[model samples]
Target: MLKVQEIREIIKLVDQSSINEFTYETNGTKVSMKKAAENVVVQSQPVVQVEKEVTAVQPTQATAQPVQQEVKETVEPTAKESTVNFDHEITSPMVGTFYAAPNPESDPYVSVGSKVNKDTVVCIVEAMKLFNEIEAEVSGKIVEILVENGELVEYGQPLFRVKTK
Candidate 1:
C-alpha cells in the first residue's frame, strides 16, 4: 500500500511530463507506475518490504539504477516540446524521381507562392516506368517547395510546404 502523498506526487509527474512510465526501488520495495492509455487505465504496483532481523533499508546493486532512470524519464517532456514541430509537414507517399515539369522542355507544375486547389497538380514523381502526377490534397498557398527537380525521392520525403488557408 502506498501513502496518499505518494499517489499525488505520481499524478503530478504524469501531468507535467511526457513520460509514459516510471519505476522506483529501494531495498526490498519496488514501485512501478504508468499513465493511462486512451484515458481509460490507471494502474499502480507497490512492493512490500520484508522486515526480518535487519531493519536497515539497504539498496542492492539491482535496485540502484531505478532512481536515476526515474529522473531521466520524468524530464522527457520538456526536452521533446522544445524540439518537435508538427505543423505543415508534407511527406512523400511513394519512392520516385521528383520532376518539376512534365517533360524537359515543359513548364513546371507549380512553384513557391502558387495557390493550389485539391485537384491542382503539384509535381510529377516517376515510379518504375510510370510518371505519376502528384496532386495537392489540401487547398492552400504554397509556402515553399522542398525538393529540387530531377532529385531522387524516398517514401515520406517532404516535397512542398503549403500554408493551409
Candidate 2:
C-alpha cells in the first residue's frame, strides 16, 4: 500500500497535468486517480494481502500537498454539545460508500440534531453498484456523523452517534 504522502503527491501531479486520468502500479498495488469538477477522486486496489483498512481522502488544490489530516477514520465528535455518553452508535453492516442523502441534489436523510425513529433511513451505503438503505435501529437524535459523503466505510464502523433520550 502507498503511504498517504505518496498518494498526495500523485494527486498534486495529476491536478497540474492536463491528462484527465492517471494510474500508478507498483508491488501489487494499483491506484487510479481522476479529476472531476473541483474534486480529485482516487481509487485503490491492492492485490497483496494486508490488514483490512478503508480510507477516503479528499484532495484540495489550494496547496501543493494535500492535508494528511483529512484522511481519517471514524472520529467521535469532541464538542460538548455533540458528545454522547454511552449512547447508541449506528454502525455500518457492510463496507460501502457512505451517502448521507438519497441523491446529490436532495437534503440528507439525517443530520446533526435530526430526530429519527427505528425505521428511519439515516443514510445509504452503496456496495457493488447496489444502494442499501441503512436504518437507525434505535430511535433518537443524531449527535454526529462520523464519515463524510462519498467516503468508503468499513464493516461495523460507527457511522453515527444517536443520543437516546
Candidate 3:
C-alpha cells in the first residue's frame, strides 16, 4: 500500500511534468493518473481476493469485488441555484482539506455573521501538508459557510458566501 505522502508526491511530480498519462501497479494495487487540460485526474484500483468452499451437500461461489476511486478537481455551480443574493464567495484555490482554524485547538478564522475585509484570512486549505491561508477577497459579512471543517475541497470550490458591504 502506498502512503498518503507517497501518493501526493506522485501527483505533484505528474502535474509538474509534461507527461499526459502515468500508471503504477504493485502488490495488487494500481494507481493511474491522466492530465486533462489544466487538471489531473487520479484513479486507484485495489485487488480483492475471495475464497469459495465446496462440499458434497452444497456448493459455494466466490466473487471478487471491483474497487473504484475518482478524484474530481473542479465543480461548477449551476446558474439555477439560489446563490444570487451573495455578492461574493470565498473559494478554495486548490484541491485539499479545508480547515476553518489554524489548528485543532484554535478558534476558526471566521464564522457565519463575521465581518471580514478584503485581506482577512477566512480559512486554511491544506494541500500536500502545506497550510495555505485563504483570504476573503471582498469586504463583506460572512453569510454562509459552504463547507464543513476537515472536509475535502476541490479547486475553486466555494468555502464561504459573503454579502458585500
Candidate 4:
C-alpha cells in the first residue's frame, strides 16, 4: 500500500501536470484521480477614461496636448504571493471539504495565533467519505487561516500560514 505522504506527492504532481487523470495499482492497492473541469466566467468591466497632459518635443518645435488614456488598477494578491513573509504553509493534500474540527460540536483544531508542532493536527479534509487529518508540518504559530470551515478545497490549496520558530 502507498503511504499517505507518497499519495499526497503523487496528487500534487498530477495536479500540476497536463494529465487529466491518473491511476496506480500495486500489491492489491489502487488509487485513481481525475481533474474536475473548470468553468471560467468572464465579466466585462466599465472602462475608465483618464485625461492627462502630454508634451511633444521635436528638434524644431515643442507642443503640449491633452490626451485621454484608459488605465486599470488592481491590487489583489494571489494565495502564494499573499503569504510571502510566512515561514510555512499547510496545504490540503487532496480535493475535499475542509473541516476545522473533528466534528461540528468540537472546537477547531487550530486558530490564528495557536502554537503548533510538525505533528499537530490542524484540520481535516474529507474526501470520498474518508476524513484525512492534516498536520501543521512545521513548528510555528498560526499566522492566518486561509479557508473557512466546511469550505471546498482543491488539492494543494494553502490552508494555513505559519511563522516558524
Candidate 5:
C-alpha cells in the first residue's frame, strides 16, 4: 500500500510532467491514472474503424500542421520539445476486460512506441461475449498505457494517451 503522501506526490508529479498518464506498481498494489477526455472512444472494429464517429467532447480542434512544425523545430532545444502536452485519452465506451493482444499468444494491438491514426486498432475490450476494437481518433505516438491486459475497465475509463504532434 502507498502512503497518503506518496499518492499526493505521484499526482503532483503527473501534473508537473504534463505526462497525461502514469502508472505505478509495488508489492502487488497497482494504481493507474490519466488525464482523460470525456468523449474519447476506446473501441473500434477494423472493418468499421474508418467510419466510427465519436462525440466531440470539446468543440475545438488543434491544427495538425503547426503542431507538427513546432515539434520538429523545438525537439532539438528541449527533450520534451514542442510535443503538445495535450492528451487524447482513449477511454472504454462500455465496461469490459481489456486485452492487449487478440489472444494470449498474439502480439498486442499497440505498444509504447506505436504510431497510431484514427483507424488504428489499439486494443480489444471484451464485454459479455463480444470483443470491441479500440481506435485512436488522432494521429500520434502512444506515450503511455493506463490499463493492464485483462483488467476490468469501466465506461469512460482511459486506456492510453496519444502524444499528438
Candidate 6:
C-alpha cells in the first residue's frame, strides 16, 4: 500500500514537470497520472503491467483510493510572433478564448492606429463560460494584434502591441 504522503509527492512532481502523462508499477501497486487542462487525474490500482501489456494482479494488503485535483497551470500556447519594436503588449490574464469583438458582428474593441488610454478596453478573454474584458494598461496607439479572434490564449500570452505615447 502506498502512503498518502507518497502519493502527494508524486502529484507534486508531475505538476511541476513538463511531462503530461506518467505511470508507475511495482509488485502490488500501479499508479497512472494524466493532466487535462488545469486538472490532474490520478488513478491508483493494485495491478501489474509488463512489457506494454496489462495484467490483472491483486494487492497484498489494503489499497489507496483514487485522487483528483485542480492544478493551476499556465499551459503554453502555440503562437506566431510578429515584428515588434519598443511596443508594449497587452497580455491575457488567464487561459481561455480570445475575442476581438463583443459579439460576432460587432466591431473589434481596437485596431491598428487606435488611440487608447489605460482605461480603454482592448479585448475580451473568455474562460470557463465567463467573458472578461481586457484593458490597455498603458496609453498608446495600437500597433498590431498578435492573436486571432476565437483563438485559445495562455496566461501572459501577448494579445496586442501598443506604441505607447
Of the candidates shown, which would achieve the greatest TM-score relative to the real structure? 4
Q: Which stretches of candidate 4 lie over 4 Å from their true place?
A: 1-84
- Evaluated against the true structure, the overall lDDT of model 4 is 0.72
Model 3 residue runs over 4 Å out of place are 1-84
lDDT of each: 0.64, 0.77, 0.78, 0.72, 0.66, 0.76
Candidate 2: tens digits of C-alpha lDDT, residues 1-165: 678986776676566544466665555667888889877899998645434354556676775665344323443332235445538999999866789999999999999999999999999987767899999988889988887887665568789999887
Clashes of 6: 0
Tens digits of per-residue lDDT, candidate 6, 84-125, equal 664698999986678999999999999988999999999998
Measured against the true structure, the TM-scores of the candidates, in listed sequence, are 0.47, 0.52, 0.52, 0.54, 0.49, 0.51
lDDT comparing candidate 3 with the true structure: 0.78
Better of 2 and 5 by TM-score: 2
Report the poorest 10 consecutive residues by lDDT, candidate 2: 71-80
Q: For candidate 6, what is the TM-score? A: 0.51
After superposing candidate 2, which stretches have Cα over 4 Å from the reference?
1-82
Candidate 4's residue-wise lDDT over 1-165, tens digit each?
566787676666556555465554444444666777742222222223345555543343365544445445544322234734688889999977789999999999999999999999999987767899999989989998988886656677788999999
Looking at candidate 3, what is the lDDT of residue 155? 71
Worst 10 residues of 5 by lDDT: 69-78
Error of model 4, residue 1, in angstroms: 32
Please give the TM-score that candidate 1 achieves against the real structure. Answer: 0.47
The lDDT leader among the candidates is: 3
Q: Count the backbone clashes (under 3 Å) in each candidate.
A: 0, 0, 0, 0, 5, 0
Ten-residue stretch with the least lDDT total in model 6: 70-79
lDDT of 1 at 35: 62
